[model samples]
Target: MVDQDIFDRLLQFRPSGAPVLSVYVGVDGGPSALRTKLESLVGEVLEQAEAEPSQALRRSLLSDVARVLDLAARGGPPEGSTVGIFACHRAGLYEEVVVPRRARDRAVVDATPYLRPLLAFLDESRRYCLVVLDRMQACLYELFMGELEGATIVVTPGKPGRPVGRDPSPAHRLFRETADVADEFIHATRAELLLVGGPEETVAAFLPFVPHHLRGRVAGTFAFDPRTMGPEQARCCAEAVVDRYERAEEASLVAEILDRVTTGGLGAAGIPWCLAAVNEEAVQFLLIDEEARASGSACDACGWLGLVGATCQRCGGPLRVTQDVIEEMGAAVIGASGRVEHVQAPTPLSQHSVAAFLRFDVPHSAAQVVG
Candidate 1:
């Protein structure tokens, strides 16, 4: 999974002397199939670039390709549905990141690593903290991108000589300490949500002890015993809650976007308006149906994107066809630090396939209407 520091590093990576190579393959058909797919996709890209006149580029590409093949052969294929391999041997940079989501199968030989697909996944993915509470102990775990880790324990805070914060009972003291630890983890990981687990009566009593700010982030609670439930079992518990929470959030967000579109607020629906919003850097939040697809054109010179255009609206440059411009638009929004979410279909956004909450109203001139 991609973290902020790693994402920032990838974003800032500069090639030493040769262009970078990035390949992403989904782990659908198991390890053997994953190996075959990686070889096929990367081979195709390398074959196309074989005739490039630059010796340095060829040597670097080949070296990185060798590294990838070696890793696939020796180290086991990554866990999860998608794996991203970024290599720039000349620059001494190589990274393999696996994510819980699925992405397109494509390889790019570019000046920097390709990151749009990963960025899109990260936009929908949120870090979660799970706290299983007990009267004298609280077990905290961090959940992200389908992985659960760090089963750290926070016990009642009355140190031998130190004065722990005054509390009415052992349960209250444990809850307070647990809240403090949860708050720290949330702040550290930038966790957008949280879930609590434990006895029913205990949880009912503990909710009030959570800080006001954290109370809002606590999506729900589960019942479990920290001693009996292992990490994997607890992960299953948290995953279910996170899944339900996100589905509900997506529905609510789509509804808001639809309402905003109708009321002339800061929102847009359908391909053309969303394309325009992204191109103009006015999208604050972008939402799209996962299965939606649209063919669009993009400007080569100025990088302006739209649903259909014979000539670039911004720079009058020649336009090129893109098979799926929704992906492009999502990448563009990410480039501008805007959030993009791929919502499951059957929601209100199914008809439009695309929507956005704008950062500011797009002017008439910048609006690229459908032809």
Candidate 2:
């Protein structure tokens, strides 16, 4: 699983003398078939890079790729549907990230590994707490990317002889304890959305006990038998709510980007201008179309980004061409602490394909970078 710590480590890595090979592919097959597919992909990579410019670099890259395949062959099939392999032998970096979501099938060999998609997926994935409550007990569960992470159960104290309506009775104390446990979980994880489920009566009674600040983050409530409900069912319910929230957020983001571009305030549209802004470290927000694709070059020596150039305009370093320029740009944006949003299909941004919000304007004489 790609956790937060692993993601942060990848972001901090820098180009050490040799280029890194980053590969992402969908291996959603049975054990035997997955191994076969990975082997085939390795073979394709070797053949495709046969005519690469640097023979020594190509040899080292293929060797690392083969080592990655060997490790995959030795291990059991991955639980996640997709896998990401980042290898840089010189830098002593080799990691296999298995994630539940699907990723594009592509390979990039650059001074630094390409990790935009992996980071983007992690950024978009939300963690939620599903609190299943009943009169007797309240169960607090942590769910990440639709998977049951961990859970805790706090049972209501019982005063067998006390009257139920009394303020100090077990019934009142039980509700109080349940609310306290929920509050602790909220504070620990800083979770925004809460999925409350139980008998209708218990759920209704429980909401009033929740802290006032957390009440607004309650996405919705559902009915479930606490005695019979399991983790899988709870995860499914939470995922449904998260999906709806994500969709609405994506729509709103697209609208805002379009609006910014129209007003010509902080936003920029078109590939050349966006790339130029990226070169200048002026982009604050990157908007990428779902189907956006471009080929461009980056110079490691001076960190110059452009399309027409085969060499760095600043330091005269040779340009490294990338097949997926959008991915490269996404990685760069994140490296500089900028946020990115993937505009989904059937959107107005499709015509421009790429856009961004810049921190400052580019002078006309400095905007264009000639080859």
Count the clashes in each prediction.
0, 0
Looking at candidate 2, the ten consecutive residues that score lowest on lDDT are: 362-371
For this target, which candidate reaches the highest lDDT against the unseen true structure? 1
The global C-alpha lDDT for each of the candidates, from Candidate 1 onward, is: 0.78, 0.73
lDDT of 1: 0.78
**RMSD score of candidate 2 (Å):** 4.0
- Model 1 over residues 1-371: C-alpha lDDT tens digits? 56667766776664354767888877765656667877888886678558767888788888888777665566555555687889988788888887876688888776567776776677667789888876778888888887887887978753345445555576777787778778889998888888998877888988998899888899889887877777777888888887788878889999999998898888888888778888888998899887788878876566688877799878887776666677677767876988889886369798989889998997434554533
Which ranges in model 1 have alpha carbons more than 4 Å from their true place? 3-23, 26-33, 36-71, 74-77, 86-96, 100-117, 156-168, 363-370
Q: Model 2, stretches more than 4 Å misplaced?
A: 1-19, 25-30, 52-55, 76-78, 90-92, 104-111, 134-136, 156-179, 198-209, 220-227, 314-316, 343-346, 358-371
**Candidate 2 residue pairs in clash (backbone atoms < 3 Å):** none
TM-score of each: 0.76, 0.80
